[model samples]
Target: MLSVQPVSEAGFAAMAEEWRMCLEASDANPLFMSWPWLYSWWETWSQVLGMELVLLGVFDQRGELVGIGPFCRRVLVTPGGVRVARLYMIGNAWRLAPTVRTEYCAIIARRGSEQAVTAALVPALEQLKWDEMISTDVPVDQLESLKVGRFYDQRGYRMIHRTEDVGIRINTTGRFDDWLAGLGKNTRLKAYNRRSYLKKQGELDFLDHEEGRDGDFFGRLNAFHMNRWGKPAFDREALRFHRLLLQRLHLCEGEPAMSLILYNEHCVSVLYDVVVRGCRYNLQAGYEEDFDPKVSLGYLHLGHAIEAAFSDGATSAYDLLAGNGKNQFYKSHFHGEAVHFSTFQVVRSPLLKALYRIQAASPLFMARGLSRRVGL
Candidate 1:
């Protein structure tokens, strides 16, 4: 039989090696599920929100650590204005700014132990006090693959609260040239011809974190993001968390990467990506605000990044973690597989569950007014 125990911050910290081992042995070894990623969020962003941690450690009969359910408690509002005390996966809280939206969310469990972990979690979770349990940005297949969300439903406790069917998944098989050759004529031009053209515009350079240039890289990335989107991608504390994460990944997962494309003295484009478990996830990016749209400076930079992912023997896929982000309509034109992520919540409170069902049927604005007066 598996046993559940609450872990303190220090206890979780001490489990770093065990966490890494479990992650590597798991079916879904996404960066978001990595210890450094979530722990950094817990140490910085979650702490900033004053959320209370609810880390659960699942142990086998021999007292072997098999899984970790890193959760936190916070009061969150539903689309229908139903305010409930939500027990959210550590990295999958309400998307407050200066925070990241974690995907491939799951209980960090060992490979064959997924079913056991999910089953063990039920009784363990039921013993805790919370109105609902939320695990967001979970890939659809994970229900069967990891025996997660759908497992809860089978146990009589889950709802598909929201679905985000947007992200792009690039199949980076074979060599770079082979992959590039498969692109259509226009895409071929944008990735090659346009990039070559940009290089001729005087002193065009590409710099990355490997050169020990991460200091300036992040600054330029933030500036380009602010100029292009009129807001920053990451604020001070969040940036610190990422910097710590970079260090942690360096020592834990495979080499993480960051890229900055410079045109003369101006930084035209930048991207921050985490490479782990044979996949490169483009977490954030930015580009020149006034650069010629025809040149597609961001696209060119992304081409370079994609090429890097292909070049690396350790990485197999370059996932554009959704959104048409590279300056308005960039992601739409990419040739890659589409991966969908959905947020699943288990509402334990009958009152809150009814309100959410009603809100699901109501108009967008009506959600803001529904259950505003409801307590608990």
Candidate 2:
């Protein structure tokens, strides 16, 4: 028999070793979903943010842990009353290649018992008395390749939301020359001229920093980032969180990782990133107002960053994250694929609907409007 148990403090403590083992056994990369920050975020959200944490344990007949499902509980209030709902927190997770992480592999069961385990776990989760349940960071074939959405459909949950597809770009197995050869003549010429102009001016250089060893770099990085991004659409807390992320990289005391500040004598433009497992992440970039808009300094910065990644022997170069119309159109210029993702919602009652509305409408709790309202 398989049983589902709520994740308790003692439970996570006991299962910590098992979790690590399963992750390695399953061949999951640490950067994707096994970062220490995942645990940190879970703890912070559950403790500081008051979100309820539930870790469903799927055990085999032998009573050992087979699978773990981590979710957060959110309350939805409506005219009728308040109802308990489980939130996937997908958008809020802020991860690259989220679903590709192996930890999300659903129902880790012994060979013959896979279907049986899922069959039992479905009703088990559905019966938890919550008005609705959401599973984010889910695999494409969530229910043993049966697609859990179908299972949810059999029970009564309907899919309500979806987002545009996202994508990741790679350029490792070949040389930069090869990549250039692969592009159209016009694109190749444009990229070559752009890079050549920047290099010839001798203003283009990359400032390097390590996690703990580069305190000065971080200081300048903070000032550069703040002076560039501070007054934009982001809120104070959100911006603080972004800086804390950089600080973690600068302060984590690990391998000799690198954060690059691509700049010229005239202006700073982009931040190129390399993380655990030879992954290169590109930031949106900031440039001095005078030198930024006319020359497309940010795009040039990316061209330089990609060149640097190739020189540094990185396996892949990701374009930071996703973008909207103009931004998305710009990304298409790189000739990469975009991934489409959707959100599934099962509104148990009016209360749940109302809660979702508030979350959807006022991400950051309407801090954007609040800031403008107070003229801050």
Candidate 3:
């Protein structure tokens, strides 16, 4: 028989090795699902938000760990302005906020045991008293394997699915020349011209920094990021969360990488990335605002980083992760495939279900206004 147990923060800390092993065995694992990233995120934000850790650990009859669900309990205001308790995958509550985001969330179940694990998890989840459950950025097949739709239908819970933003992934396995050739002629020429212009302006230097070696880089990076957006990108809590993530990566030997573009010894642009299992996830980036606007330092730095990744043979794909639909412009330049993401909501309350239906039927702008008001 399979058994499920809720693991608190302390319990989770003690089961680091077990969790990591389960992650390794799971087919749906991604950097966001890594023990280091989720643990650090829990440490940084859970208490601040007054949320309770509700991580679930599943074990088989032989007492072997089979799956893990990194979940948390929080209060969410529904579209009708009713506040209710809800459960969500860790880091998912920040989905609408302009903060550090995690994508590709799913139950970390051993490759062939996903169905069984989901069957067990569905019952375990039902035992908890929550108004709704929201999970975002889940892969389509993974969710289907979970059979959440069928499970919810049987239990009379309303399951709603919405198409989220698409995730952009750049395949870097091909030869560098071939990769460049794949980009349209206009984009290729623009990249070349940008690099040439930057090179002529000053001595161009590209530097890579590991986790522990990034000294004052985060501060400068955040400043540049805020300046570019004309507003702050990360709050104090988010900064702390990012710092803890760096430390966690270092401890786990995750080999987090930060690429810097320097012009005459002055940092002009930077790209923070995590490379694991030949997949490079672009976490964050920023560039000096005072640089020559015509040179396009940001684009030049990204091109340099992609080239470096190909040269080092350290990456198979560069994932831009989920973001606003506007990123299609720059991401399209890379000629990458767009992986669509969706959010699934399971509602147990009739009132909430009615509210969701009404919101869904409303005009786009009205629904958006209500969403903002509800803090979605």
Candidate 4:
């Protein structure tokens, strides 16, 4: 049996090395669970949200730290004005000014000790006071082991398991050239042709985020994304959060993956990625639409970025992340393998469980009412 201890926010900051070790020993999303990403997120948003923070530290019989649950509680008010005390994985706070998508969120544990950690987790979490707990955007394999959907079933918590085939990714073999060569002949040709077409216009350069161009790259990334979408990508606070995250990752792990494609000394595209455990998660990308109507800037930029990922030893996969709830399925064109994210919701009390069900369907209720009031 493992023992679980509740860690305060200040003490949790000091567990970077321990957290990294457990992450490597386990199969969690290293990028999302990394100290740099979550800490920076807490540093940025917790101040605004004033979340009740607690980090659960799982220890083996030997008293070694084998797991960490970065958890928090926040009270959310519904349209009906009921205040619900909600439990959340620290990184999944949504619709905030600095709302960064945290994919593959999970409980971090040592590989061999997953069951022990989960066993210890139930009692620890039950001691806390929360009506319901939610942790989403997690991959299925991890969820299978964590069993978060049913983690607290013994405590009379109702369990609901939800899933979505939302992730897209391309796996890489051992070598960069081999991976490029394995692509369909048409894809390979187009990837090359896009770059060649741009080269014809002027000097083409592929620059990685580094000391000389860190600020420049981020500025262009925000500008290009905002211009393309007609709204700011990160807003002011999110920009600051990302800037700090990328810089900190660069310093600690040397993973400055925000890449740029330049055409004739002009910025044409930027791809934001976070590389961890040999997989590169392509978070966001923005390109100059005016470069050429005929040229697929994203396709062109991705080829360069994937090559860098391969060269940098990030050969696990190039994850395009997910396209959930979006009308456009441009990522499908990449023809990468599908990825699924699972969500677990556990409501401890019957009364709160009723609220959970209602909130889950609130959107449909809202739309129907709106349509009736406005006569569609």
The candidate that achieves the highest lDDT relative to the unseen native structure: 3
* TM-score for each of the candidates: 0.88, 0.68, 0.90, 0.87
RMSD of each: 3.1, 7.3, 2.8, 3.8
1-376: candidate 2 lDDT, tens digit per residue: 7777776766664565565544444333333343233444454344434456555667767777665455556554433344345554312332211211122323344445556556766666566666655544334444232244467655455444433244446554458777767766655555454666656755565555554644543344455557656744223433443444444442222122344435454335435354544656553355453553325654555655566666766455544444443334565555544533333445554544554565556758584554344321
Model 1: residue 263 alpha-carbon error in angstroms:
2.8
Question: Number of the top candidate by TM-score?
Answer: 3
| Candidate 1 lDDT by residue in tens digits, 188-214 | 787667866766767777787555544
* Model 4: residue 55 alpha-carbon error in angstroms: 1.0
- Pairwise lDDT winner, candidates 2 and 4: 4
Candidate 3: residue 141 Cα off by (Å): 3.4
| Reference-based lDDT, each prediction | 0.74, 0.48, 0.76, 0.74
Candidate 1 vs. true structure, TM-score: 0.88
The candidate, 1 or 3, that scores higher on TM-score is: 3
Cα-lDDT of candidate 2: 0.48
Span of ten consecutive residues with least summed lDDT in model 1: 143-152
Write model 3 residue lDDT over 1-376, tens digit each, in one string.
7899888778888876887778878876457888888888888777777788889999999888999877898876656578887888887674434446778888889988888888889889888878888887786656774436577776688888766667778888878778888888767765554777767777887898644765677777878878888754567878788778877774444767788877888777888888876788887788877787577666676777777767767578877776652244576677788887778877887877876777889999988886777644
Q: Which candidate, 1 or 2, would have the higher lDDT against the true structure? A: 1
**lDDT digits (tens) for residues 222-316 of candidate 4:** 68867777876677668777877876774335375777777767677888887766788887888886777767787778878777666665466
Error of 3 at 110 (Å): 0.6
Candidates in descending lDDT order: 3, 1, 4, 2
